[model samples]
Target: MIHITLPDGSRKPFEDQPTGLAVAKSISEGLARECVAMEVDGQLVDLNRTIENDAAVRLITTRDPEALEIMRHSAAHVMAQAVMHVYPDAKLTIGPVVEDGFYYDIDMQPLSEEAFPEIEAEMKRIVKAKIPVERHEVSKANALEFYKNEPYKTEMISELADGTISFYKQGDFTDLCRGPHVPHTGFVRAFKLMRVSGAYWRADQSKAQLQRIYGTAFFDKKQLKAHLEFIEEAKKRNHRKIGTAMDLFSFHDDAPGMAFFHPKGMAVWNALLDFWREAHREAGYVETKTPIILKRALWEKSGHWENYRENMYTTEVDDEAYAIKPMNCPGGMLLFGTRPHSYRELPLRVAEIGLVHRHEMSGVLNGLFRVRSFHQDDAHLYMMADQIQSEILDLLRLEEKMYSQFGLDFHLELSTRPEKSIGTDEQWEVATEGLRAALDAYGRDYLINEGDGAFYGPKIDLHIKDALGRTWQCGTIQLDMSLPERFDLTYVGKDNEKHRPIMLHRTVFGSIERFLGVLIEHFAGKFPLWLAPVQAVLLPINDDLIPFAEKVASTMIQAGLRVEVDDRTESLNRKVREAQLAKTPLILTCGGKEKEAGTVSVRTLDGSVHYGIPMQQFMQQVTAHVAERRLELDLFEK
Candidate 1:
């Protein structure tokens, strides 16, 4: 008899080896029907795999969060099977699950969007067949012989150490994989092939180019429909299209992944900077600027040279190598070592908005979200060991204050040390516990993400949710003990002896350009009054009133408002339509009636009109609204 421990601390005795599906059936038939996979000793595996020894097990049903990944994995296999059915000569390389979806790369002829329909139809046919997926483990020698005809598969197997290899077979199709997929093809009820693109085999340009098919799967049909709707809405809010239509920014082939900001875009950028400066000033931080390029020796000492060499851009100067800074912490370390410090100044908070550059693949470069050159809002805090919790709490408060200004809601996550990390075990434990205690004291719930922290230390990551219910990883606070020791930084203690100070690296905006991109989509290009590039535009009722419109614009501009005057030979309706398309927050119209009365007709972006308001009163209201940085528009209310 074998004993099994369940999640609820219950035990069951089974005769000989039992599969997870059998365990589920012992509890209830409904559970057996819903079971998609299982976890044994905290490792996910196929439901049909037999349990060999006494262990703890938890059956994963379709309703569980883990089921999505299992289902998506199975969907990829079904997709590969479907492709083979259509084109027997196609060679498979890899199929992996990614964020929100899965994809498979195949060495085949170039495919177009027109081929998606047939491929999708074949996938649906396979799913409806309810074919069982069987896992087979074989010796490396057998695997090598089995895949002799597939060069990509043979190459992958040759690189692996000599051991048993796993493959999954469904119907007449088989592929190399180590997976815990869904029980059968029926679990993949709803899936769609999103797109087809070209990719080099291992991301090396010198390797064979292959066709990559992208897709997404869901357990429920309703969920799939809702996801498709969200994709459509996302297309309408694409920042690149809106940015070009508004003439805010542009990108040229000369600098493929770099953004060139126009005057209007600079207006929004400066406004964000002003608020950042005010918040940091009140939080007791001193700003600093560092060189954009540093000697290679400095990076070698900081450990980035050995670990991050591929992503860095290097140049030779004076017979020595120099690298463009990919991060700001190394330079900040040099600044901290510039002078000796006493414990009284132990909690030295330094901040910088430094521009950094990295080498990114041209294929993965996005508008502003994935750029090669961008600015980082970085801060380094040095403090005593006892001050860790308090400093963390302070940083959390600052993060809240800044995010709330933009009406953003965020969730916290505590990431533990990764596999290949520096520092001793005791140091990691202390740092991880320090962050945990801070979150507890702050009275907020956070998720524990195991093995995802920086190599130097454990950290707290902030994932902010935008208006469309999409989350972005924007803020982080990392505790580092490695850098201080590497740089040999020390401060005088109260007892007149030198001591090492704990270091904390943090950022509210991971990338300024990425945050701007999120903001554009969050607002659908309808920015708030304070953040709007052009706050207001004055439209003349006719060519005769052009002078009056210009006069009002001049007054508003002098009062620190970004204003424009429309004096084109166009009708009033056309001008109003153009202004609305530009997403102007306020549109002011001047004509004979308004000019004679010294009043103006104001129109808002939402098409709400307030008639004949005194020009001076209007200016006061507009200025107050912008100064307050209100999230919503509530102007001229009773």
Candidate 2:
């Protein structure tokens, strides 16, 4: 008898060998019908695979995370089959599931949107056939011989050492793959071809170009519908689209990765920076500025040469090389090394709004989110060993306070040291323990991201949630002990002996440009009053009230409000519409009746209109709202 354990911790005795399919049927017909694949001892495998020993098993259905991946894998096979049916001469390579979906690489005629529909029709026909997917294991020699005529497949086979390879067959088509696919083709009920983009074979620029088909799949109709709707909604809220409509910001080819801050964009940028600076100051930070370009020797000494040289841009000046700073830490290190200090000055917090440049692939650049040039709201703390935990907790508290003001909730990631990291195990252990103690003191739970830290030390990363339920990594705190030692930074202790200070590098905004992009999407361009490019627009009913409108705008501007005068020769309704579309938090309209009475009509963005409020009271309320930096408009409820 073979012992089998289910995910729920129940054990079953199966005589001799039993397939996962038979095991599922023994549990329940409903389970057997729904299970598309099985997990055997944490590895995904075909349902027909026989188990002869004691192990745990999991029946993956349509609702599980792994279920979507399997469905996409099967869909890729179906797509390949469709391509083969249409063009038998085309060579197939690899197709893998990615974060959002899957893509199949094929060497054939260049693909266009025009060629997609026919291929999709063939795929639909294949899906309707409900063909069974069969998996078989074969020796590598036989596998190579099977696809000997296909150069790419033969090349791949030559790369594989002597081992068994798995191949999946559906109908008359077969492909080399490791799959735990859906039971039958009928399960691919909903899928769509998204786009056709250029891709170099094997992602090697020197290799031949291949046509890659991108598609997404889901278990059933509802999930597929929701995904499609999500795409539409995301398109509507895309920064590229909404930024132009709301006059937030723009990009030009003349200065790639450099932000063009329009008046509105500048207003929002200043608002965010002001908030960040205030929070940092309150959390005991003193800000400084670092040089944009530094000697390459500094980076070499900091070990960035061995790790981050590829992403760095270099220049020759005075017969020596200088690097456009990719990060601010090295410069901060040099600044710390400039002079000796006393232990009494230990736990010093230094910050800088430093602009750094790193090379980003041109193809992947997306507005402000991925850029080559951006400013980091960076800070470094020189703290004593005993102050590590408390200092980190203070930083955590400030991060929470700042993000909460933006109405953002965040997730935490604790990344451990990498394999090629500097510093001894003992040093790393102490640093990591300090980070954990701080996290515990602050009562913050985090997910471990193994092997995802800097070359110097482990770190904590914070990912903030947006309105659409998507998360962006905005706030971060990283503990580093290596840089101080690298730069030979020292401070005199109370005992009059020199000692290296622990460095805690942190950023509330990892990249200001990226954070701005996320903010635009999170608010859907409806900026809060304090951050809105125009806090209030003064609209005159006609050219007759232009003088009064201008006077009110001047008064509001003098009161430290961003007020705009809409003195156009347009109707009141038209001006109101413009203000509403502009997302101005407040619209102050003056007409013959209101201007004569020395009162103004207050119209907030949420469609609440209060008629005939005293100008003094209106100014007081608007100033109060702006000063508070409320994330939401506190307009009176209708």
Candidate 3:
């Protein structure tokens, strides 16, 4: 007899070994019908797999979060089967589920969007067949024999250390996999082939090129439709398209993966820096600047030469090798070591808007989001051991304030030490615990990501969600014990004894350029009044009203607002449309009626107009909105 424990603390004794599906049927037929997979002893497995010994089990149905991945994995197999049915000569490489979808790499004639319809139809036919999926384990010799004609599978088998390998089959199709897939083909009810792209076999460019087919799956047609709609919305909000339309920034062949900011874009960038400076100054931080090129030996001392040399851009200068800065922590450490400090100055905060360069792959060079050169809004806080919690709390509060200012919602993740990290285990534990305790006291939910920290220490990362529901990692607070020891940084304690200070590395905006890219998409280039390059534009109804428009522009400019006048040989309507397209916050019009009355007609971005407002009153409302950095035009009554 075998005893099986359930999530609710219930146990059942079976006379013989039973499959997970059999156990589910014993509890309730409805559960058996809905369940697609099972978890035995915390390991997900096929429902039809036998359970021979006492263990805890949980049935995974469509309602469970884990079911999506299971369904997607099954969909990948179904997709592979469909491809084989259509093109018998096609060779399969590998298929796996990724974020929001699954993909299969195949060695066949490159497929375009034109082939998606037929492939999708074949997948539907397979789903309609409702074929049962069977799992089998075979010895290494038998596995090799089964896949003798498949080079990819043979290569994969040679790398496996297990004596026996697993394979899954449905109908005439079979593939090597370690799966917790849905029970049968019918479970992949709603799916769509997204796109086809080129990917080198094994991700090596020198290897044979393969066609990668990307697709997504959902439990029902309604869910799939909703997800497709969300994808469409994301495309509309893509930063590259919006940035080009707004003429904010551009990328050129001469400077690939680097952004050349226009005047208007620089206006927004400077505004962000101004806000950062004010916040840091109020929080008792002193800003500093460091050389962009430092000797290679300095990086070796900081461990970057060993762990991060590949990403660095190095050059020879004065018969010595120097590297462009990839991180600011090392420079900050050297600055701290430049002067001896007493205990009174232990909690010193040094901030820098440092320029950094990294050698990103050409294929991954996204606009500003992934760039070779960018500015990091970085800071390092040196404090005593006992001050860790308080200092971390302060940084968290500052992070909250900065993100909230842009109306961005963010979630926290605590990442622990990685495999290639420096420092002793005990040192890492203390540093990680200090961060965990601070987050606990902050009274918010956070996730733990193992082995995702910096090379020197653990960190708390902040991922901010944009308007289209996509999340971007923008802020982080890292606790480091290695840099201090590497640089021999010290301060005199109260007892007149030299002691090492703990270093907390942090950044509210991990990179200014990337954050601006996110913000561009978040606002759809319709920035708020204060952050908008041209806060207000004055349009004359005719050339006769040019003087009045110029007067209004001068008044706004005097009030410290970014104002412009449109005196071109164009109609009022055309000028207004241009301003609207430019995403200017306010459009002010002055004509004969308003010129006589010393007033102006105010038109907002949303097309609501307040006519014949006194100049003084209009100035007051606009000034107030800019002063408060209001995201919406609430200061003016519509």
Candidate RMSDs in order: 1.8, 2.0, 1.5
Which of the predicted structures, 1 or 2, would earn the higher lDDT when compared with the native? 1
Off by over 4 Å in 2: none
Off by over 4 Å in 1: 10-13
How far in Å is the alpha carbon of 189 misplaced in model 3?
Answer: 1.2
Q: Please report, in order, the local distance difference test score of every candidate based on alpha carbons.
A: 0.93, 0.87, 0.92
Off by over 4 Å in 3: none
Model 3 TM-score (2 dp): 0.97
Candidate number of the best lDDT: 1
- TM for candidate 2 is 0.95
Number of the candidate with higher TM-score, 2 or 3: 3
Q: Looking at model 2, which ten-residue stretch has the lowest summed lDDT? A: 629-638
Give one digit per residue, the lDDT tens place, for model 2 in 512-531. Answer: 98998898888888888888
Q: Which pairs of residues collide in candidate 1?
A: none
Q: Judging by TM-score, tell me the better candidate of 1 and 3.
A: 3
Give the C-alpha miss distance for residue 224 in model 3, angstroms. 1.0
Candidates 1 and 2, the one with greater TM-score: 1
User: Model 3: per-residue lDDT, tens digit, 1-638?
Assistant: 98999999999989999899989998999999889999999999999999989999999999999999999999999999999999999999899999999999999997998999999999999999999999999998899999999998899998888698999999999999999788889999999999998888886878999999999999999999999999898777777888887778999999999999988888888888988999999999999999999999999999999999999999999999999999988888889988889999869999999999999877678889999999999999999999999999999999998899888999999999999989999999999999999999999899999999999999999999988778999999999998999999999999999999999999998999999999988998889888988888988888888887887888889998988899999878999999998888889888899999998888888889988898898888889888877777775665
For each candidate, give its TM-score against the true structure: 0.96, 0.95, 0.97
Please report how far candidate 3 places residue 5 from its true position, in Å: 1.4
The numbered model that scores best in TM-score is 3
